[model samples]
Target: MFSGAQISLYPMADDFVSVIMAALTGLDPWREALRIETDDISTLLVGPPEVLFAAMRDLFVRAAQTGVHCVLSAAVSRGCPGEPDDPICMAQGGFARDLALPDRIAAARANVGLAAVTGQDVAAQFSLYPLGEGPHMDEIYGCIDFLKASGTFDRSKNFCTRLRGDAGPVFATLCEAFTNFGTVAGHVVLDVTVSANSPSAR
Candidate 1:
Protein backbone atom coordinates (compact mmCIF):
# COMPACT_ATOMS: atom_id res chain seq x y z
CA MET A 1 0.00 0.00 0.00
CA PHE A 2 1.14 3.60 -0.51
CA SER A 3 0.76 4.20 3.23
CA GLY A 4 -0.05 7.87 2.68
CA ALA A 5 -3.17 9.83 1.82
CA GLN A 6 -3.86 13.50 0.99
CA ILE A 7 -6.84 15.78 1.11
CA SER A 8 -7.49 19.16 -0.54
CA LEU A 9 -10.52 21.14 0.45
CA TYR A 10 -11.80 24.67 1.07
CA PRO A 11 -13.03 26.18 4.35
CA MET A 12 -16.61 27.26 4.52
CA ALA A 13 -18.97 27.86 7.43
CA ASP A 14 -20.06 24.27 7.05
CA ASP A 15 -16.97 23.75 4.90
CA PHE A 16 -19.11 22.75 1.96
CA VAL A 17 -17.64 19.30 2.45
CA SER A 18 -20.55 18.02 0.50
CA VAL A 19 -19.50 19.85 -2.65
CA ILE A 20 -16.11 18.23 -2.28
CA MET A 21 -17.68 15.01 -1.15
CA ALA A 22 -19.94 14.96 -4.17
CA ALA A 23 -16.90 15.20 -6.39
CA LEU A 24 -15.27 12.32 -4.55
CA THR A 25 -18.24 10.11 -3.72
CA GLY A 26 -17.69 8.20 -6.92
CA LEU A 27 -13.99 7.84 -6.32
CA ASP A 28 -14.35 4.52 -4.55
CA PRO A 29 -17.49 2.63 -5.31
CA TRP A 30 -16.44 -0.20 -3.03
CA ARG A 31 -16.05 2.32 -0.13
CA GLU A 32 -14.82 -0.57 1.97
CA ALA A 33 -11.09 -0.62 1.32
CA LEU A 34 -10.75 2.78 3.02
CA ARG A 35 -12.77 5.14 5.15
CA ILE A 36 -13.96 8.71 4.45
CA GLU A 37 -15.21 11.08 7.06
CA THR A 38 -15.21 14.71 8.29
CA ASP A 39 -15.53 16.78 11.46
CA ASP A 40 -16.26 20.43 12.14
CA ILE A 41 -12.68 21.47 11.52
CA SER A 42 -11.45 19.21 8.71
CA THR A 43 -12.59 16.66 6.21
CA LEU A 44 -10.74 13.39 6.62
CA LEU A 45 -10.56 11.39 3.41
CA VAL A 46 -8.36 8.34 3.30
CA GLY A 47 -7.67 5.91 0.51
CA PRO A 48 -5.09 5.06 -2.15
CA PRO A 49 -2.84 8.03 -2.81
CA GLU A 50 -3.34 7.88 -6.55
CA VAL A 51 -7.09 7.81 -6.22
CA LEU A 52 -7.17 10.68 -3.74
CA PHE A 53 -4.83 12.91 -5.71
CA ALA A 54 -6.73 12.42 -8.94
CA ALA A 55 -10.01 13.00 -7.19
CA MET A 56 -8.84 16.26 -5.56
CA ARG A 57 -7.55 17.55 -8.89
CA ASP A 58 -10.90 16.87 -10.47
CA LEU A 59 -12.63 18.64 -7.59
CA PHE A 60 -10.62 21.81 -8.06
CA VAL A 61 -11.36 21.84 -11.79
CA ARG A 62 -15.07 21.42 -11.17
CA ALA A 63 -15.04 24.21 -8.57
CA ALA A 64 -13.46 26.59 -11.08
CA GLN A 65 -16.04 25.76 -13.75
CA THR A 66 -18.76 26.44 -11.24
CA GLY A 67 -17.30 29.92 -10.48
CA VAL A 68 -16.99 29.14 -6.79
CA HIS A 69 -13.82 30.56 -5.30
CA CYS A 70 -12.05 28.41 -2.70
CA VAL A 71 -8.85 28.39 -0.73
CA LEU A 72 -7.33 24.92 -0.80
CA SER A 73 -5.34 23.69 2.17
CA ALA A 74 -3.93 20.24 1.96
CA ALA A 75 -3.82 17.47 4.55
CA VAL A 76 -1.37 14.60 4.39
CA SER A 77 -1.80 11.82 6.89
CA ARG A 78 0.12 8.58 7.21
CA GLY A 79 -2.04 5.72 8.28
CA CYS A 80 -0.90 2.48 9.86
CA PRO A 81 -2.48 -0.66 8.52
CA GLY A 82 -2.51 -2.29 11.94
CA GLU A 83 -5.64 -0.47 12.97
CA PRO A 84 -8.39 1.52 11.30
CA ASP A 85 -8.80 5.02 12.82
CA ASP A 86 -12.18 5.80 14.14
CA PRO A 87 -14.18 8.04 11.78
CA ILE A 88 -12.88 11.57 12.34
CA CYS A 89 -15.45 13.34 14.54
CA MET A 90 -13.49 15.75 16.65
CA ALA A 91 -13.24 19.49 15.94
CA GLN A 92 -15.23 22.72 15.78
CA GLY A 93 -18.88 21.89 15.46
CA GLY A 94 -17.33 18.56 14.44
CA PHE A 95 -15.08 20.16 11.77
CA ALA A 96 -11.72 21.89 11.72
CA ARG A 97 -11.92 25.60 12.59
CA ASP A 98 -8.66 26.29 10.81
CA LEU A 99 -10.43 28.40 8.23
CA ALA A 100 -8.90 29.93 5.14
CA LEU A 101 -7.77 33.53 5.25
CA PRO A 102 -8.40 36.47 2.92
CA ASP A 103 -6.48 36.06 -0.28
CA ARG A 104 -4.92 39.08 -1.99
CA ILE A 105 -5.74 39.27 -5.68
CA ALA A 106 -4.05 41.34 -8.37
CA ALA A 107 -6.54 43.47 -10.26
CA ALA A 108 -6.89 46.75 -12.16
CA ARG A 109 -9.64 49.00 -13.42
CA ALA A 110 -9.87 51.46 -16.31
CA ASN A 111 -7.87 54.54 -15.31
CA VAL A 112 -8.79 57.18 -17.85
CA GLY A 113 -6.26 59.53 -16.27
CA LEU A 114 -3.39 57.10 -16.69
CA ALA A 115 -4.53 56.35 -20.21
CA ALA A 116 -4.27 60.02 -21.07
CA VAL A 117 -0.73 60.34 -19.68
CA THR A 118 0.44 57.23 -21.57
CA GLY A 119 -1.41 58.38 -24.69
CA GLN A 120 -3.37 55.15 -24.22
CA ASP A 121 -0.34 53.32 -25.55
CA VAL A 122 2.83 52.65 -23.56
CA ALA A 123 2.20 51.81 -19.89
CA ALA A 124 2.87 54.35 -17.11
CA GLN A 125 2.19 54.84 -13.40
CA PHE A 126 -1.51 54.11 -13.20
CA SER A 127 -4.18 54.62 -10.58
CA LEU A 128 -6.79 51.93 -10.62
CA TYR A 129 -9.15 49.96 -8.42
CA PRO A 130 -7.67 46.65 -7.41
CA LEU A 131 -11.02 45.12 -6.57
CA GLY A 132 -13.34 46.76 -9.03
CA GLU A 133 -17.06 46.47 -8.67
CA GLY A 134 -18.76 43.72 -10.60
CA PRO A 135 -22.22 43.49 -12.12
CA HIS A 136 -23.27 41.10 -9.40
CA MET A 137 -22.61 43.22 -6.37
CA ASP A 138 -24.96 41.17 -4.26
CA GLU A 139 -23.22 37.94 -5.07
CA ILE A 140 -19.80 39.41 -4.45
CA TYR A 141 -21.03 40.89 -1.20
CA GLY A 142 -22.40 37.53 -0.19
CA CYS A 143 -19.05 35.90 -0.86
CA ILE A 144 -17.28 38.61 1.04
CA ASP A 145 -19.79 38.29 3.83
CA PHE A 146 -19.24 34.57 4.07
CA LEU A 147 -15.52 35.13 4.05
CA LYS A 148 -15.95 37.55 6.92
CA ALA A 149 -17.88 35.07 8.99
CA SER A 150 -16.17 31.79 8.15
CA GLY A 151 -12.76 33.09 7.05
CA THR A 152 -12.33 35.02 10.31
CA PHE A 153 -12.33 38.50 8.74
CA ASP A 154 -13.77 41.66 10.25
CA ARG A 155 -17.14 42.44 8.73
CA SER A 156 -17.18 46.09 9.74
CA LYS A 157 -15.78 47.33 6.47
CA ASN A 158 -15.95 46.30 2.81
CA PHE A 159 -14.23 42.97 2.43
CA CYS A 160 -13.15 43.80 -1.09
CA THR A 161 -9.58 45.05 -0.95
CA ARG A 162 -6.41 45.97 -2.81
CA LEU A 163 -3.30 43.88 -2.30
CA ARG A 164 -0.97 41.35 -3.92
CA GLY A 165 -0.43 37.62 -3.76
CA ASP A 166 2.74 35.54 -3.43
CA ALA A 167 2.07 34.02 -6.84
CA GLY A 168 -0.08 34.82 -9.88
CA PRO A 169 -2.85 32.56 -8.64
CA VAL A 170 -4.56 35.45 -6.89
CA PHE A 171 -4.54 37.56 -10.03
CA ALA A 172 -5.79 34.67 -12.08
CA THR A 173 -8.63 34.20 -9.61
CA LEU A 174 -9.63 37.87 -9.83
CA CYS A 175 -9.56 37.83 -13.61
CA GLU A 176 -11.77 34.78 -13.60
CA ALA A 177 -14.14 36.35 -11.11
CA PHE A 178 -14.46 39.51 -13.17
CA THR A 179 -14.91 37.58 -16.38
CA ASN A 180 -17.72 35.66 -14.76
CA PHE A 181 -19.34 39.01 -13.97
CA GLY A 182 -19.12 39.96 -17.67
CA THR A 183 -15.98 42.09 -17.58
CA VAL A 184 -14.49 42.87 -20.99
CA ALA A 185 -10.95 41.54 -20.88
CA GLY A 186 -9.59 44.32 -23.04
CA HIS A 187 -10.23 47.04 -20.47
CA VAL A 188 -8.31 45.56 -17.52
CA VAL A 189 -4.88 47.09 -17.06
CA LEU A 190 -2.41 45.75 -14.51
CA ASP A 191 1.35 46.07 -14.16
CA VAL A 192 2.17 44.07 -11.08
CA THR A 193 5.77 42.99 -10.73
CA VAL A 194 6.64 39.67 -9.10
CA SER A 195 10.07 39.08 -7.65
CA ALA A 196 11.45 36.33 -5.49
CA ASN A 197 13.43 38.61 -3.17
CA SER A 198 10.76 41.12 -2.27
CA PRO A 199 7.22 40.99 -3.56
CA SER A 200 6.35 44.32 -1.91
CA ALA A 201 9.54 46.22 -2.60
CA ARG A 202 10.61 48.66 -5.30
Candidate 2:
Protein backbone atom coordinates (compact mmCIF):
# COMPACT_ATOMS: atom_id res chain seq x y z
CA MET A 1 0.00 0.00 0.00
CA PHE A 2 1.21 3.48 -0.85
CA SER A 3 0.61 5.82 2.07
CA GLY A 4 1.04 9.56 2.17
CA ALA A 5 0.20 12.30 4.67
CA GLN A 6 -0.29 16.03 4.49
CA ILE A 7 0.35 17.69 7.84
CA SER A 8 0.32 21.23 9.15
CA LEU A 9 1.94 22.11 12.47
CA TYR A 10 0.46 25.04 14.32
CA PRO A 11 2.22 26.15 17.48
CA MET A 12 -0.08 28.35 19.50
CA ALA A 13 2.30 31.10 20.50
CA ASP A 14 3.26 34.59 19.41
CA ASP A 15 6.78 33.44 18.66
CA PHE A 16 5.70 30.36 16.78
CA VAL A 17 8.50 30.41 14.24
CA SER A 18 10.92 28.70 16.60
CA VAL A 19 8.34 26.11 17.48
CA ILE A 20 7.65 25.32 13.85
CA MET A 21 11.35 25.18 13.16
CA ALA A 22 11.90 22.79 16.01
CA ALA A 23 9.24 20.48 14.64
CA LEU A 24 10.67 20.68 11.12
CA THR A 25 14.11 20.06 12.55
CA GLY A 26 12.92 16.82 14.00
CA LEU A 27 12.27 15.57 10.49
CA ASP A 28 15.76 16.59 9.37
CA PRO A 29 17.41 13.58 10.97
CA TRP A 30 15.13 11.33 8.97
CA ARG A 31 15.31 13.32 5.72
CA GLU A 32 17.30 10.68 3.95
CA ALA A 33 15.07 7.91 5.24
CA LEU A 34 11.85 9.45 3.96
CA ARG A 35 10.43 11.52 1.13
CA ILE A 36 9.18 14.87 2.46
CA GLU A 37 7.90 17.82 0.50
CA THR A 38 6.73 21.10 1.98
CA ASP A 39 4.60 23.85 0.48
CA ASP A 40 2.58 26.79 1.67
CA ILE A 41 -0.30 24.56 2.78
CA SER A 42 1.25 21.48 4.36
CA THR A 43 4.10 19.07 4.27
CA LEU A 44 3.69 15.89 2.28
CA LEU A 45 5.27 12.66 3.48
CA VAL A 46 5.37 9.46 1.45
CA GLY A 47 6.68 6.31 3.03
CA PRO A 48 5.83 3.01 4.65
CA PRO A 49 3.60 2.90 7.71
CA GLU A 50 6.41 2.33 10.20
CA VAL A 51 8.60 5.09 8.87
CA LEU A 52 5.71 7.49 8.43
CA PHE A 53 4.45 7.07 11.99
CA ALA A 54 7.96 7.19 13.40
CA ALA A 55 8.65 10.48 11.67
CA MET A 56 5.35 11.92 12.85
CA ARG A 57 6.27 10.94 16.43
CA ASP A 58 9.48 12.91 16.29
CA LEU A 59 7.97 15.87 14.48
CA PHE A 60 5.03 16.34 16.85
CA VAL A 61 7.05 15.68 20.01
CA ARG A 62 9.55 18.34 19.08
CA ALA A 63 6.70 20.77 18.57
CA ALA A 64 5.13 19.78 21.90
CA GLN A 65 8.44 20.25 23.72
CA THR A 66 8.05 23.98 23.16
CA GLY A 67 5.46 23.91 25.98
CA VAL A 68 2.96 25.95 24.03
CA HIS A 69 -0.38 24.85 22.65
CA CYS A 70 0.48 22.89 19.53
CA VAL A 71 -1.91 21.24 17.13
CA LEU A 72 -1.12 18.79 14.34
CA SER A 73 -3.58 18.56 11.49
CA ALA A 74 -3.11 15.67 9.13
CA ALA A 75 -4.81 14.11 6.12
CA VAL A 76 -3.42 10.67 5.50
CA SER A 77 -4.25 8.06 2.90
CA ARG A 78 -3.13 4.69 1.56
CA GLY A 79 -3.28 5.01 -2.22
CA CYS A 80 -6.66 6.04 -3.53
CA PRO A 81 -8.02 3.70 -6.15
CA GLY A 82 -7.10 4.44 -9.81
CA GLU A 83 -4.15 6.58 -8.78
CA PRO A 84 -0.73 5.62 -10.00
CA ASP A 85 1.37 3.93 -7.38
CA ASP A 86 4.02 6.16 -5.93
CA PRO A 87 7.31 4.32 -6.20
CA ILE A 88 8.78 5.99 -3.15
CA CYS A 89 6.12 4.41 -0.98
CA MET A 90 7.40 1.01 -1.94
CA ALA A 91 11.03 1.74 -1.04
CA GLN A 92 11.98 0.22 2.30
CA GLY A 93 14.59 0.28 5.07
CA GLY A 94 14.66 3.57 6.93
CA PHE A 95 16.08 4.44 10.35
CA ALA A 96 13.79 5.84 13.02
CA ARG A 97 14.05 9.51 13.99
CA ASP A 98 14.63 8.68 17.64
CA LEU A 99 16.29 5.55 18.96
CA ALA A 100 15.76 6.00 22.69
CA LEU A 101 12.09 5.01 22.72
CA PRO A 102 10.06 2.80 20.42
CA ASP A 103 8.21 4.67 17.63
CA ARG A 104 4.57 4.09 18.69
CA ILE A 105 5.26 4.61 22.39
CA ALA A 106 7.32 7.70 21.73
CA ALA A 107 4.53 9.45 19.84
CA ALA A 108 1.91 8.31 22.33
CA ARG A 109 3.99 9.54 25.25
CA ALA A 110 4.33 12.98 23.70
CA ASN A 111 0.55 13.24 23.31
CA VAL A 112 -0.33 13.71 26.95
CA GLY A 113 -0.92 16.47 29.49
CA LEU A 114 1.42 19.26 30.56
CA ALA A 115 3.05 17.33 33.38
CA ALA A 116 3.65 13.72 32.53
CA VAL A 117 0.70 12.65 30.40
CA THR A 118 -0.82 9.50 31.90
CA GLY A 119 -3.90 7.53 30.80
CA GLN A 120 -2.52 7.80 27.26
CA ASP A 121 -5.54 9.54 25.75
CA VAL A 122 -5.36 12.56 23.45
CA ALA A 123 -8.35 14.58 22.32
CA ALA A 124 -8.74 15.10 18.57
CA GLN A 125 -11.19 17.15 16.52
CA PHE A 126 -12.04 16.02 13.02
CA SER A 127 -14.16 17.58 10.28
CA LEU A 128 -14.07 15.48 7.17
CA TYR A 129 -15.09 17.24 3.96
CA PRO A 130 -16.13 14.90 1.21
CA LEU A 131 -15.79 16.48 -2.18
CA GLY A 132 -15.83 15.90 -5.99
CA GLU A 133 -18.25 13.01 -5.67
CA GLY A 134 -21.94 12.21 -5.46
CA PRO A 135 -23.92 13.53 -2.54
CA HIS A 136 -21.19 15.12 -0.42
CA MET A 137 -23.34 14.80 2.65
CA ASP A 138 -23.69 11.09 2.09
CA GLU A 139 -19.95 10.63 2.10
CA ILE A 140 -19.75 12.89 5.11
CA TYR A 141 -22.38 10.82 6.88
CA GLY A 142 -20.53 7.64 6.05
CA CYS A 143 -17.44 9.03 7.70
CA ILE A 144 -19.57 10.25 10.57
CA ASP A 145 -20.92 6.75 11.08
CA PHE A 146 -17.45 5.30 11.19
CA LEU A 147 -16.25 7.99 13.58
CA LYS A 148 -19.25 7.55 15.85
CA ALA A 149 -18.55 3.85 15.98
CA SER A 150 -14.95 4.60 16.82
CA GLY A 151 -15.26 7.70 19.05
CA THR A 152 -17.51 10.56 20.22
CA PHE A 153 -19.41 13.11 18.18
CA ASP A 154 -20.37 16.63 19.13
CA ARG A 155 -24.03 17.01 18.14
CA SER A 156 -24.01 20.79 17.98
CA LYS A 157 -21.18 20.77 15.50
CA ASN A 158 -22.09 19.70 12.01
CA PHE A 159 -19.67 17.27 10.32
CA CYS A 160 -17.44 17.48 13.34
CA THR A 161 -16.40 14.64 15.65
CA ARG A 162 -14.14 14.44 18.65
CA LEU A 163 -12.29 11.32 19.68
CA ARG A 164 -10.23 10.61 22.75
CA GLY A 165 -7.96 7.60 22.90
CA ASP A 166 -4.44 6.31 22.43
CA ALA A 167 -2.62 8.17 19.67
CA GLY A 168 -1.96 4.97 17.75
CA PRO A 169 -5.53 3.72 17.40
CA VAL A 170 -7.05 7.16 17.05
CA PHE A 171 -4.69 8.00 14.23
CA ALA A 172 -5.19 4.58 12.67
CA THR A 173 -8.93 5.13 12.60
CA LEU A 174 -8.50 8.59 11.14
CA CYS A 175 -6.34 7.21 8.37
CA GLU A 176 -8.89 4.52 7.64
CA ALA A 177 -11.63 7.11 7.32
CA PHE A 178 -9.70 8.76 4.53
CA THR A 179 -9.29 5.47 2.69
CA ASN A 180 -12.89 4.51 3.21
CA PHE A 181 -14.23 7.66 1.61
CA GLY A 182 -11.55 8.02 -1.03
CA THR A 183 -11.82 4.49 -2.38
CA VAL A 184 -14.55 4.92 -5.00
CA ALA A 185 -15.30 8.61 -4.63
CA GLY A 186 -13.60 11.40 -6.48
CA HIS A 187 -11.57 12.81 -3.57
CA VAL A 188 -12.03 13.62 0.06
CA VAL A 189 -10.18 16.14 2.13
CA LEU A 190 -10.01 15.82 5.89
CA ASP A 191 -9.62 18.59 8.38
CA VAL A 192 -8.03 17.15 11.51
CA THR A 193 -6.64 18.83 14.59
CA VAL A 194 -5.04 16.81 17.37
CA SER A 195 -3.85 18.27 20.62
CA ALA A 196 -1.58 16.00 22.58
CA ASN A 197 -1.32 18.34 25.53
CA SER A 198 -3.22 21.57 25.90
CA PRO A 199 -1.70 24.04 28.33
CA SER A 200 -5.05 25.72 28.91
CA ALA A 201 -6.84 22.51 29.78
CA ARG A 202 -7.21 21.93 33.50
Candidate 3:
Protein backbone atom coordinates (compact mmCIF):
# COMPACT_ATOMS: atom_id res chain seq x y z
CA MET A 1 0.00 0.00 0.00
CA PHE A 2 3.04 2.29 0.20
CA SER A 3 3.48 4.66 -2.73
CA GLY A 4 5.03 8.02 -3.66
CA ALA A 5 5.52 10.45 -6.53
CA GLN A 6 7.93 13.15 -7.76
CA ILE A 7 6.86 16.45 -9.28
CA SER A 8 8.12 19.61 -10.94
CA LEU A 9 6.37 22.97 -10.56
CA TYR A 10 7.72 25.39 -13.09
CA PRO A 11 7.96 29.21 -12.67
CA MET A 12 9.90 28.39 -9.51
CA ALA A 13 7.18 29.54 -7.18
CA ASP A 14 8.28 29.28 -3.54
CA ASP A 15 4.70 29.09 -2.40
CA PHE A 16 4.18 25.82 -4.25
CA VAL A 17 6.80 24.26 -2.07
CA SER A 18 5.11 25.57 1.07
CA VAL A 19 1.67 24.54 -0.12
CA ILE A 20 2.88 21.05 -0.97
CA MET A 21 4.53 20.72 2.40
CA ALA A 22 1.37 21.93 4.04
CA ALA A 23 -0.66 19.30 2.22
CA LEU A 24 1.81 16.58 3.23
CA THR A 25 1.87 17.70 6.83
CA GLY A 26 -1.85 17.07 6.74
CA LEU A 27 -1.35 13.55 5.36
CA ASP A 28 0.54 11.54 7.96
CA PRO A 29 2.77 11.67 11.02
CA TRP A 30 6.19 12.24 9.56
CA ARG A 31 8.94 10.05 10.90
CA GLU A 32 11.79 11.61 8.90
CA ALA A 33 12.20 14.25 6.18
CA LEU A 34 14.81 15.92 3.97
CA ARG A 35 14.99 18.33 1.07
CA ILE A 36 14.86 16.41 -2.26
CA GLU A 37 16.40 18.50 -5.00
CA THR A 38 14.24 18.05 -8.07
CA ASP A 39 14.82 19.32 -11.59
CA ASP A 40 13.07 22.46 -10.37
CA ILE A 41 13.66 22.32 -6.59
CA SER A 42 14.37 19.63 -4.03
CA THR A 43 12.63 17.94 -1.15
CA LEU A 44 12.72 14.47 0.43
CA LEU A 45 9.62 13.23 2.25
CA VAL A 46 9.09 10.00 4.18
CA GLY A 47 6.00 8.67 5.95
CA PRO A 48 2.98 6.39 5.75
CA PRO A 49 1.46 5.32 2.45
CA GLU A 50 -1.87 7.00 3.00
CA VAL A 51 -0.36 10.30 4.08
CA LEU A 52 2.32 10.34 1.40
CA PHE A 53 -0.36 9.73 -1.18
CA ALA A 54 -2.68 12.42 0.12
CA ALA A 55 0.14 14.90 -0.13
CA MET A 56 0.95 13.71 -3.64
CA ARG A 57 -2.66 14.23 -4.69
CA ASP A 58 -2.76 17.67 -3.16
CA LEU A 59 0.48 18.55 -4.89
CA PHE A 60 -0.87 17.47 -8.25
CA VAL A 61 -4.03 19.49 -7.74
CA ARG A 62 -2.16 22.60 -6.72
CA ALA A 63 0.49 22.16 -9.35
CA ALA A 64 -2.09 21.71 -12.08
CA GLN A 65 -3.85 24.83 -10.95
CA THR A 66 -4.76 27.55 -13.46
CA GLY A 67 -1.69 29.68 -12.78
CA VAL A 68 0.75 27.07 -11.49
CA HIS A 69 2.67 25.45 -14.32
CA CYS A 70 3.04 21.84 -13.38
CA VAL A 71 4.42 18.52 -14.50
CA LEU A 72 3.85 15.52 -12.27
CA SER A 73 5.04 11.94 -12.40
CA ALA A 74 4.89 8.94 -10.10
CA ALA A 75 7.12 5.95 -9.70
CA VAL A 76 8.52 3.29 -7.44
CA SER A 77 10.77 5.30 -5.14
CA ARG A 78 11.85 3.61 -1.90
CA GLY A 79 12.08 6.20 0.92
CA CYS A 80 12.51 9.84 1.99
CA PRO A 81 12.39 12.36 4.94
CA GLY A 82 8.61 12.08 5.19
CA GLU A 83 8.97 8.58 6.57
CA PRO A 84 11.56 7.25 8.98
CA ASP A 85 13.41 4.05 8.12
CA ASP A 86 11.95 0.99 9.71
CA PRO A 87 14.86 -1.14 10.83
CA ILE A 88 12.65 -4.18 10.93
CA CYS A 89 11.75 -3.81 7.27
CA MET A 90 13.63 -4.63 4.09
CA ALA A 91 12.62 -1.79 1.75
CA GLN A 92 15.45 0.68 1.10
CA GLY A 93 16.35 3.68 -1.02
CA GLY A 94 18.39 3.60 -4.18
CA PHE A 95 21.25 6.12 -4.49
CA ALA A 96 21.28 8.48 -7.44
CA ARG A 97 23.11 11.71 -8.24
CA ASP A 98 24.32 13.96 -11.01
CA LEU A 99 20.90 13.50 -12.44
CA ALA A 100 20.90 14.43 -16.10
CA LEU A 101 17.22 13.62 -16.25
CA PRO A 102 15.22 12.02 -13.47
CA ASP A 103 12.12 11.69 -15.65
CA ARG A 104 14.33 9.88 -18.13
CA ILE A 105 15.79 7.81 -15.32
CA ALA A 106 13.00 5.33 -15.77
CA ALA A 107 13.94 5.10 -19.39
CA ALA A 108 17.58 4.60 -18.45
CA ARG A 109 16.54 1.85 -16.10
CA ALA A 110 14.81 0.40 -19.12
CA ASN A 111 18.25 0.61 -20.81
CA VAL A 112 17.34 3.52 -23.07
CA GLY A 113 19.71 6.34 -22.05
CA LEU A 114 22.88 4.35 -21.49
CA ALA A 115 24.76 6.18 -24.25
CA ALA A 116 24.02 9.57 -22.69
CA VAL A 117 25.20 8.59 -19.21
CA THR A 118 28.31 7.09 -20.84
CA GLY A 119 28.75 4.76 -17.91
CA GLN A 120 27.32 2.05 -15.73
CA ASP A 121 27.62 1.15 -12.10
CA VAL A 122 28.58 4.80 -12.04
CA ALA A 123 29.27 4.99 -8.31
CA ALA A 124 31.81 2.19 -8.51
CA GLN A 125 33.37 3.80 -11.54
CA PHE A 126 34.30 7.00 -9.71
CA SER A 127 36.51 8.33 -6.88
CA LEU A 128 35.70 10.96 -4.28
CA TYR A 129 37.44 13.45 -1.96
CA PRO A 130 36.40 15.84 0.77
CA LEU A 131 34.73 19.08 -0.35
CA GLY A 132 37.92 21.21 -0.05
CA GLU A 133 40.58 19.04 1.52
CA GLY A 134 42.85 18.43 -1.39
CA PRO A 135 44.17 19.34 -4.82
CA HIS A 136 41.34 17.12 -6.13
CA MET A 137 37.69 17.59 -5.03
CA ASP A 138 34.64 19.43 -6.25
CA GLU A 139 31.97 18.00 -8.58
CA ILE A 140 33.90 17.99 -11.86
CA TYR A 141 37.06 16.68 -10.22
CA GLY A 142 35.09 14.01 -8.44
CA CYS A 143 33.67 12.91 -11.81
CA ILE A 144 37.17 12.80 -13.26
CA ASP A 145 38.42 10.83 -10.28
CA PHE A 146 35.48 8.49 -10.68
CA LEU A 147 36.38 7.85 -14.33
CA LYS A 148 40.08 7.51 -13.53
CA ALA A 149 39.62 5.05 -10.70
CA SER A 150 37.27 2.72 -12.51
CA GLY A 151 37.59 -0.85 -11.18
CA THR A 152 40.15 0.11 -8.54
CA PHE A 153 38.32 0.86 -5.30
CA ASP A 154 35.27 -0.69 -3.71
CA ARG A 155 34.27 2.53 -1.96
CA SER A 156 35.71 6.02 -1.45
CA LYS A 157 35.88 7.92 1.86
CA ASN A 158 35.46 11.56 1.04
CA PHE A 159 31.79 12.65 1.07
CA CYS A 160 29.28 10.77 3.14
CA THR A 161 27.24 8.09 1.28
CA ARG A 162 24.20 5.92 1.64
CA LEU A 163 23.97 2.34 0.46
CA ARG A 164 21.33 1.65 -2.20
CA GLY A 165 19.44 -1.57 -2.18
CA ASP A 166 17.89 -3.72 -4.87
CA ALA A 167 15.50 -1.86 -7.16
CA GLY A 168 12.54 -3.48 -5.42
CA PRO A 169 13.64 -2.56 -1.91
CA VAL A 170 15.17 0.84 -2.61
CA PHE A 171 11.97 2.76 -1.77
CA ALA A 172 11.69 1.94 1.93
CA THR A 173 15.30 2.14 3.11
CA LEU A 174 15.92 5.81 2.34
CA CYS A 175 15.46 7.01 5.90
CA GLU A 176 17.66 4.26 7.30
CA ALA A 177 20.41 4.91 4.80
CA PHE A 178 20.30 8.14 2.72
CA THR A 179 18.29 10.61 4.86
CA ASN A 180 20.69 10.29 7.78
CA PHE A 181 23.86 10.22 5.71
CA GLY A 182 24.82 13.47 7.47
CA THR A 183 25.02 11.50 10.69
CA VAL A 184 27.50 9.04 9.25
CA ALA A 185 30.45 8.59 11.61
CA GLY A 186 32.87 10.00 9.08
CA HIS A 187 33.38 13.40 7.50
CA VAL A 188 33.88 12.07 3.98
CA VAL A 189 31.60 11.53 1.03
CA LEU A 190 30.80 7.85 1.07
CA ASP A 191 30.78 6.14 -2.32
CA VAL A 192 27.81 3.82 -2.46
CA THR A 193 25.78 1.75 -4.92
CA VAL A 194 23.03 -0.79 -5.00
CA SER A 195 23.76 -4.48 -4.38
CA ALA A 196 22.36 -6.18 -7.43
CA ASN A 197 23.23 -8.74 -10.03
CA SER A 198 24.83 -7.31 -13.12
CA PRO A 199 27.95 -7.30 -15.26
CA SER A 200 31.31 -6.03 -13.97
CA ALA A 201 29.96 -2.60 -15.05
CA ARG A 202 33.15 -1.60 -16.80
Global lDDT of model 2: 0.61
Residue-level lDDT tens digits of model 3 in 141-176: 434333223222244345533222222222222211
Error of 3 at 193 (Å): 25
Can you give the TM-score per candidate against the true fold?
A: 0.31, 0.60, 0.26
Off by over 4 Å in 1: 1-8, 11-33, 79-202
Per-model root-mean-square deviation over C-alphas? 20.1, 9.0, 14.9
What lDDT does the true structure give each of the candidates? Answer: 0.32, 0.61, 0.31
The TM-score-based order of candidates, best leading, equals 2, 1, 3
Residue 197's lDDT within candidate 2 is 68
lDDT of 2 at 7: 88
lDDT at 180 for candidate 1?
22
Candidate 3 wrongly placed segments (more than 4 Å): 1-7, 11-40, 79-84, 87-202
Candidate 2 regions exceeding 4 Å error are 1-3, 14-18, 25-33, 39-41, 47-54, 75-85, 90-121, 133-139, 151-156, 184-186
lDDT for model 1, on a 0 to 1 scale?
0.32
Please report the candidate that would top TM-score against the real structure. Answer: 2
Predicted structure 3: clash tally: 34
